[model samples]
Target: MRIHLSSVFVDDQEKALRFYTDVLGFVKKNEVPIGEHRWLTVVSPEDPDGTELLLEPDVHPAVKPYTTALVEDGIPAAAFAVDDVHAEFERLRGHGVRFTQEPLEIGPITTAVLDDTCGNLIQIVHTA
Candidate 1:
């Protein structure tokens, strides 16, 4: 009854790895070569043993349009929880990350959306 792993389709695995790790601060969990691509995954540094985020390649023909539509409609592909949405937003913005939506409160929660640079929008969120 829990998420063991999740994935975000990426155009380039190498670039995604660097962004998810070096920029977003996730830690590499596994990397195994699989033909021309690899089975690469990363985990949040705060939850190393928790769910892993797979960096999957989006080479399938359907993926482009599916992801493109999501982005065009301003829908986020993945959401990561943070302790403070504002602080995390500021920190990430300071790190040169571009956000589509700034932190906005909605009822008891707050969220911000950013482009993953891999054909998806990712949301960072917190609850009040």
Candidate 2:
């Protein structure tokens, strides 16, 4: 079977929506109200019908510590594939996005890590 949906725990759904859409260029796919949080999801503009990335709220007690440990260890919460890691890194850096790891080539793959500003480190990757 193929992948369907994936998620990134976010401290603020609204801010994550803005960053994921306005900055990263994803488009909103679904938004349904669910009690205190909304079931929000986004899809790539290039493939709107492809996999959906859910902007899940990190309200669970274990989430904070988990995310905190990941950040402290310089681990990325999620990774997104880009056509050009260097170009994408430049574009994102121009948008004032803070990057923990600059674009580095490791064999045929290149990657860069940036903070989402919503308590998550997101990685952009490309393979040659």
- Top lDDT hit: 2
TM-score, structure 1 vs. true: 0.97
Residue 126 lDDT, candidate 2, scale 0-100: 92
Q: In model 2, how large is the Cα lDDT of residue 57?
A: 99
**TM-score against native, each model:** 0.97, 0.98
lDDT of each: 0.93, 0.96
Structure candidate 2, residue pairs in collision? none
* Model 1: ten consecutive residues of lowest lDDT: 114-123
Candidate 2, residue 10: Cα displacement in angstroms equals 0.4
Clashes of 1: 0
Candidate 1: tens digits of C-alpha lDDT, residues 4-86: 99999999999999999988899999999999999999999888999999999998899999989999999999999999999
Query: Candidate 2 — what's its lDDT?
Result: 0.96
For residue 13, give model 2's deviation from the true position in Å.
0.4
Candidate 2 TM-score, C-alpha based: 0.98
